[model samples]
Target: MKYIVTALICFIILVLISSCRNDFGFTSSTGSLKFSQDTIYLDTVFSTIGSSTRTFKVYNRSNDDIVIPRVALAQGTNSKYRISVDGVPGQVFENVELLAKDSMFVFVETTVDIMDFTGDTEFLYEDTIEFDSGANLQKVALVTLIKDAVFLFPERDAEGIEETILLGTEEDGVRISGFFLDDNELIFTNEKPYVIYGFAGVPPNKTLAINPGARIHFHSQSGIIVARDGTLKVNGALSTTEELENEVIFEGDRLEPLYDDVAGQWAAIWLTAGSINHEINYATIKNASVGIIMDSFNNASNGATLKINNSKVFNSSNTALLGTTASIEATNSIFHNSGQSAVVARLGGDYNFNNCTISNYWNGSFRQDPTLLISNAIPNTEFTADLTAANFTNCIIYGDRNLELALLDDGTSTFNFKFENSLLRFNDSSNSFDGIPAYDFSNINLYNQCILNVDPLFEEVAAFKLRIDNTGGANGIGDPASVTATDISGTTRSTSTVSGEGPDAGSFESSDLSGS
Candidate 1:
C-alpha cells in the first residue's frame, strides 16, 4: 500500500509541473538583493537653487535576513552636496534589516547652497552603498538637486540674442555651426524646403519662433542643432498651406500600410540645448535622423518643459522626440517610429505626453531604437550626459511587435525620468522582418502606472490607415479612462465617430465625410 501511494504521488506531481511553459521555467530561488533604482538625478542650476528629495528601494531575495551596515554617499574626496538621511547622516540607520523576500526603502535628501554656487553648471556626484558579499542588499541612487542659477545660460541674460544670416544661402547640406543671439529674435523662413546641414544659432534668453508653411528639411551630410539656453516657439495651423503641402495623402480602398517613398530618410527638425522652453504646436515633423534632440549640456533645460502640442512626428532612424528640459507636455500629437525611440528622456527630462498615438511599422515596418541607456558615469571631463525627468499620460504606444522598443542612455547632464498612466501595445508585432525584443528599460529612471501587453486592434496598420474597429473587440490601451469623452486639451467625440465597429483611439481624428 505504501509503494502504490508513492507512485501515485509522483504521477500527480509530474502532471502539475507539465502544465507550465518550459521556456520561461525557473527552478531556483535568487540569493541576491534587487534594487529598484540604480541611478538618481540631482539637476538643479544656479537660477533655481533649493533642497531636493529622492527615494530608493531595496529587496532581499535571500532566504536569510540581511543587514545593511552603512547607507551613505561614497563621494570620492571632494564633495559638493550635503546629503543626509532623515535630516542628518548621523540619524541614519546603522543596521538596516530586511527579511527574506521582503523590501526596505531609503530616502535621501540633498540641499544646495546658492551662495557657494559660483559656476553656472554643477555636477551630480555618484553615491554608493557598501555591503557584505553574502548578505543581500540593493542600492538605490536617490538623487536630488538644488540650483540657484540656470546652467544652460550661465553668462548670458535675457537681453542678449540677435539673429544672424550667414551668407544669405550657403552650400546645400552645409552646416551653419554655432551661431549666437542675444536680446533679439531669430527667424528661418524660406520659400521652399531648405536643407540646413548645420544650425541656426540662438542664445539662452532669446525667443525664436518659426512661421507656418515654412518647410525646413535637413541635408544628409549635415544636421541642424541648437545650443543650450535657447528658446524655440514653432506655430503651425491646420489651415496653413504648409499643412496641406506636407499632408499625408492616405491611399486605400480599404486600408493599406502607410507608404513613405523615403524610408529612414533624413529627418526634418533637430533641436538640442539645455534650459530653453520649447513650444511646438500644430506642426507636421517627420523624416529625419532624429526628430528633436534636447541635450542636457551646453545650452538647455525645458525638455522637461518642452511642450509639443498638436503635432505629428513620423519616420526617423533614431529617437523621434528626446528631451531633458523641465517637462514635455504634448497633447493631440502623433509619433511614428523612427529608429530605437519615439520619445526619450534623461538627466531631468520631465515629460507630459497626453492625447497621442505612437505606432511603429504602420508604414510597413515597426519603429525601433538602436541605442540603450545604461548607468551613471562622472560628467567632469570624461563622459557626456543625457539625464532626464519624464511624465507620460493619456497616450497610445503601439509596437507592430517589433523587436526594438526604447532605451535611455547616459546623460552628461542631470537625471530624473517618470512615466505616468498611459497605454502601451505590442510594438514588436512585425517579428520576422524588423522585430527586436522590447528595448532594455533598466536605463529609464522611474516608470509609474503605465500599461503594457495591450491590443489596440488597428485596422490593418500595415496599410497605414486607421479606424476604430466596431465589430471587432474593444482595443484596450491600458486604461480607457485616460481619455474620457474628452481629452486633456478638451477635444470631444461621439460613438458615431466610430463606424463598422470602428472608433478612433488616439487624441486626433481625421474629418468624417460619411456623416454616419
Candidate 2:
C-alpha cells in the first residue's frame, strides 16, 4: 500500500509540471507586436556628452505567448547608440519571451563624438531595432545638433575637487565662496554657446565683455559674478531684420520643453561690492533665483553699479532686480513674473527707472510678498543703510495681487523716493495700509502724478508679453517729457496717439511691431 501511494504522488507532480509547460508555449505570430511610438525624436545635444535616456514600450498583444527569436540593432556592433532590453544591457538580445497581454520597456541612450562624422557643427545619427527576423521593425531617429561650446569650469584638484573663491562676507559672519575666472578668459564671443559649470567670477581689475548674439547657458546653482573692482559689459544691440540678431540670452542649460518656463534653475548674476561700470543692453535674462543682485558698495567714483536698457528680466524665483545699498539705472526695460517682488530696493543707494514696466503675475507658487518692495532697513537685523534717491518716471507697476506695492521704513535714515506719471496697481480695499505713513497717498511729494488701481490690459500675461492692448487706459497718460522717444521695440511711443500725442505709461508701445 505504501509503494502504491508513493507512485500516485509522483504521477500527480508530473501532470502539474506538464500543464505549466503547455500554458507558456511559444507562438510564431510575428506581426502582432505593438510599440509605443513609431519614431522617437531625441532633441539637440552637445558633443561628447551622454544624452538623457529615452524609453519606449514593447507589447505582446496576441492571445498566445510570443517568443522574439532575435532582437538586434540594424548597425550590428558598430552603433554609437546603446540599448537595454527590459533591465538587461546589451546591443542585441535573443529569445526574449513575453506572456500574453504583457509589455516590456526598452531604454535608449547615446553619446556621439562629433569627430566621427562629417558636418559643419551638427550631425544626424540614426539606428533601428529589428525584432524577429525583420517581421516587425521599429526605428528611432536619433538626431542631435552637436554644438561646440566654450566650456567654463573650475579647476579640479588631484582628487577631482573643484576650487573656489570667497564670494563675500555676510552680516552673520558667514562666508560665501564660488568659482573664479582668470583674466585671460574674460571675453566671451558669439561663435558658440558659453556653458558654465559653476559661478564664473570676473576677478578684481578684470573686465568681461560679452559680444552680441551670445548665448550663455548655466548649470544648476551656477551664475556669473563681477568681483570687486571688476567690470562686465554685454554689448547686445537691437536688431529688427537679421535672422541671428545681436541679443544676449542667459538661462539654464536644460533644453527640454518641460523645463522651458520652470524658474529657479540657477543662481543670480551678482555684482559684488566695488564692482563698477556694468551694463546689459537688449538682453533676455530668465529662469534664475534672482535675476540681478547688486551688492552694497559705496563707489562714489564709479557712479552707478549697473545701467540696463532695452532688456527683459523675467521668471525669477526671487526679486528680479535686488538692490542692497547699490546704485542702478534702468531704462526701457521690463521686469516681470517674479516669485517675490519684481523690484526690491532695500537699503538702497540710488535707483532710477524710466519708461520701464514692473509687473508680477507669478502663478508658480503661493506668493506672500508684494510685487514691489522698497525699504531702508533689513528685517530682523540691526543693519540700516540710507536710501539716498529712488525715482520711477513714466513706468507701470501692476500685478495680480490686492496690494502690489510695499514701503517699509525704519525711520532711521533718509528714504527719498518719487513716482511721477506712473500707473500703479495698489488696492486699499481691506485698509491694510490705512494709517501707514509711507503709504499715505495724500503726500504729494512722495507720490506725484500717479494713476492708481487701473488695469493696463496686457496682451498676454501667461506668455510674458506685456504689450498694452486697446482696452488699456494708459495710452496718452504719461508725461511726454518723462517718456522716452522710442520704446523697447524701437517703435515710436506716440505712434498710436493722435489728440494728446503722449507716450504710453509702460515699457512697450502699442504698435504693429510689438510681438516678439
Candidate 3:
C-alpha cells in the first residue's frame, strides 16, 4: 500500500513540471512591432571617436510571445553603427525573444571614421536597425553628426611606453603625464576644432598662437602649458553681433549636452614661471579645474605676466584665475561661477582689473572661500612676499556669499590694495569680520566711492548673462576715467541721463541704464 501511494505522488510531481514549460512555443512576429521613436538622433561626435549611448524602446504589443527571426543592421555588419537589444550588444542578433505585452530596450552608439565620410569638415552619418526579415521587417533610423578634428595625443614607444613631458616633480618625485606640441602644430586655426588628449606643452621660446573662431577641446586631465620664455596668444576678434561670431572657445572634449556647463572636465591652462607676453582677447575659457594659472618664480619682479582683454572665464571647479607672485592686467573681462575663488592672487601679486566682473554663484555645494582672495602670504606656510599693487577699478566684485572679497596679510609684507568706483558684495550678516582691518570701509584709499552690500540685478545669473538692468545698483556709478570706452559686449559706455552718473561699474555697460 505504501509503494502504491509513493508512485501516485511521483506522477503528480511529473505533471506539474511538464505544465511549467513556457519557453518553446513562441510565434514568429508579424510586422506589428512598435518603437518609442522612429528615429534616434545621436549628438555630434569627433571622427574615429565613439559617441554617448542613446536608447529607444521596442514594444511587442500583441497578446502572444513573439520571436524576431532576425534583428540586425541594414548595412549587414559593414555599418559604423552598433546596437544592443535588451541588454545584449551586437551588430546583428538572431531569434530575439520578447514576451507578450512586454517591451525591450535598444541602445545605440557609433564611431565613424572621417575618411569614410563624404563631407570634408562635418557630415551626417545615418544607418538603420532592421527588425526581422523581408516582408515583416521594421526599421528605426540612426543619425549622428561626425565632425573632423585635429587630434593631438602622445605617441607610444615600440614597447607600449607612452611619451611623457615633465610638468614638475612632486615632493616625493611623482610626475603627471604630458607631452610637448610639435613645432608645426603650434598654430591653431579655425579651419577645424582641436581635440587634445594630454597636456600640450609649448616649448621654451616657442609661441602658441590661436586664430579667431578657434575651438579647443581638452580631454580629462588635459590642458595647455606654456613653458619658460614661451608666449601664448589667442587673437580672437570681437564679433559685430551679440552671438560672438569670432570668439575663441576653450572647453572639454565631451560634446554631449549633459556636459555643457559641467565644471572640472579638464585641467587648467598653466603659464609656467618665466613665461612672458601671454595675451588673450575675445576668448571664452570654461569647464576647467582652473581657468588659467599664472606663476612666477618668486616676487622678484612686478612685470606683466598676462594681458587679458574682452574675455570670459568661468565654470571652474577651482579658482578661475590663479596667480602666484605674477602680474596680470585684465580689462573688460568676466569671471564667475567657480567652486572656490573666481580670482585668487596668492603669495603676493600685481593685479589690475578694469571694467571687469568677478562674481561666484557656485551652486554645486557649500563653497567655503570668497569670490576674490588676495593675500600677501601663502596659507599655512612661511612664504610671504610684497603685494605690489592689487587694484580693481570700475569693476564689480560680488557673489552669492555674504563677503565676496577677502584680504589676508601676515604683516611681513606690503599689503597695498585698492577698489575705486566698484561694486562689492560684503553684506557680512554674521559680522564675522567687522573688526578686521581688511574690512575697513571708511578707508578712502582702499575703498573709494565703492557701492557695498547691494545686488547687481543680473539679467540671468544661471545663464551667465551678467548684463545689469535699469534696476541694478551698479547701473551707472563708475569712474569715467577708469572705465573702458566700450564694454565686453562692444556696448558703448556712457553717462546715464536717468541717474546722471558715469558708466556702469561691471564688464557690461547696461544700454537701458545708459538710455541707448
Predicted structure with the largest TM-score when compared to the true one = 3
lDDT, residue 479, candidate 2: 79
TM-score of each: 0.46, 0.90, 0.93
Q: Give the count of colliding residue pairs in each prediction.
A: 101, 0, 0
Specify the poorest-scoring 10-residue window by lDDT in model 2. 168-177
Query: What value of lDDT does candidate 1 attain over all alpha carbons?
Result: 0.48
1-516 per-residue lDDT for model 3 (tens digits): 999999999999999988888766689989899999999999999999899999999999999999999889889779999889889989899889999999999999999998785659999999999998778989999999999999999889999987787655655554456788889999999999999988899999999999999999999999998888898999999988766669999999889898899999999999998888899999999999999999974333545779999999989999899999888999999998999999999988788999999999999878989999999999899999889899999889998888888899998899999999899998878778887877889889899988997788887777887888756778777887668889998888985544436688989986553442
Off by over 4 Å in 1: 1-185, 188-197, 240-260, 264-268, 297-303, 324-326, 362-389, 402-421, 426-454, 459-491, 494-505, 509-516
Deviation from native of the Cα of residue 361 in model 3, angstroms: 1.0
lDDT of 1 by residue, 382-492 (tens): 444444433455456666553323433443455444444455553444444242212323223344455455554555454334333432222333234444454323345
* lDDT leader: 3
Clashing pairs in 3: none
Worst 10 residues of 1 by lDDT: 248-257
Better of 1 and 2 by TM-score: 2
42-151: candidate 2 lDDT, tens digit per residue: 66666666677888898988888888877787887998778899999998898888889999998887777776876556667777777776545545454445665677
Rank ordering of all candidates by lDDT, starting from the highest: 3, 2, 1
